[model samples]
Target: SAENVYKADGTIAKSGKLKTGFTAVIDSRTYVIAVCGDVTGEGNVNSKDVTLLQKYLCDNAELDGAYLKAADFNLDGEADNRDLVLISRQKN
Candidate 1:
């Protein structure tokens, strides 16, 4: 699964093989949970996400920290055309 759990500051809190009843405790703060490529947080990755990534790459839109993390398909700590193409080819 591409799902990722992130803390409020947009850093990954946990990842890989998440199971049911998984839990974590942290100081009072918000968190962002989403799939790696699901930048829109729609619980799935699809063509719409591809479009959003394209927009972000073309400077037609902005991606906040969490969304930027999700859009970095190669997990290389950057979002660019390579990531955009990876997102576009995502099967889910």
Candidate 2:
């Protein structure tokens, strides 16, 4: 079902490239896919996600992609180490 989405108003979400998620045939002819809850970005969010999150926590160390994302688990369009502590309290 990774096809295009067509609205009754003649709007189309078109895309020349095909991907795993939904292809929106409306919003600028692109995909309207949602990568939800993928906090780890390892393709899926699961138990091992915490490890990825921890790697990002800087210990007077260098910066990396995982650190960037981990510092801000919610991805509220910002990166702050404060978010990391919040995520650490998760059961998973």
Candidate 3:
């Protein structure tokens, strides 16, 4: 069975990253980093959801939704933004 991390809204009660390390099977090729990090699936990555990611890392908080479905910016089962460098690189 799949493991549960957080709730549906955005409250996290755990203190560890979930297991999301797996290569997706692409036809005739292996996709290494095709994981989706949109979290809320709002499209065109924006501040609304980034706030939640910041909250979890900076505020030591947790979102009530599934970590994989929300804050896991890299889809590696962690609320980190390594893939979000562009988010930080852009001028404010």
* CA-lDDT, candidates in order: 0.68, 0.44, 0.43
lDDT of 1 by residue, 6-37 (tens): 44445564645422122234454434444578
| TM-score, candidate number 1 | 0.65
| Clash count, one per candidate | 0, 8, 5
Question: What's the lDDT of the predicted structure labeled candidate 1?
Answer: 0.68
lDDT ranking, best first: 1, 2, 3
> In angstroms, how far off is 33's CA in candidate 1?
2.1
Residues 20-90, candidate 3, lDDT per residue (tens digit)?
Answer: 22223345453322224444434334664556556665766555444344445445655566645534443
- After superposition, the stretches of candidate 2 with alpha carbons farther than 4 Å from their true spots are 1-28, 31-37, 42-47, 59-71
lDDT of 2 at 56: 41
**Highest-scoring model, lDDT:** 1
TM-score of each: 0.65, 0.35, 0.38
Candidate 2, 10-81: lDDT as tens digits: 455364332223335554565433333334433444554445445545453333443354445566855445
lDDT of 2: 0.44
The prediction achieving the highest TM-score against the true structure is 1
Query: Ranking by TM-score, best first?
Result: 1, 3, 2
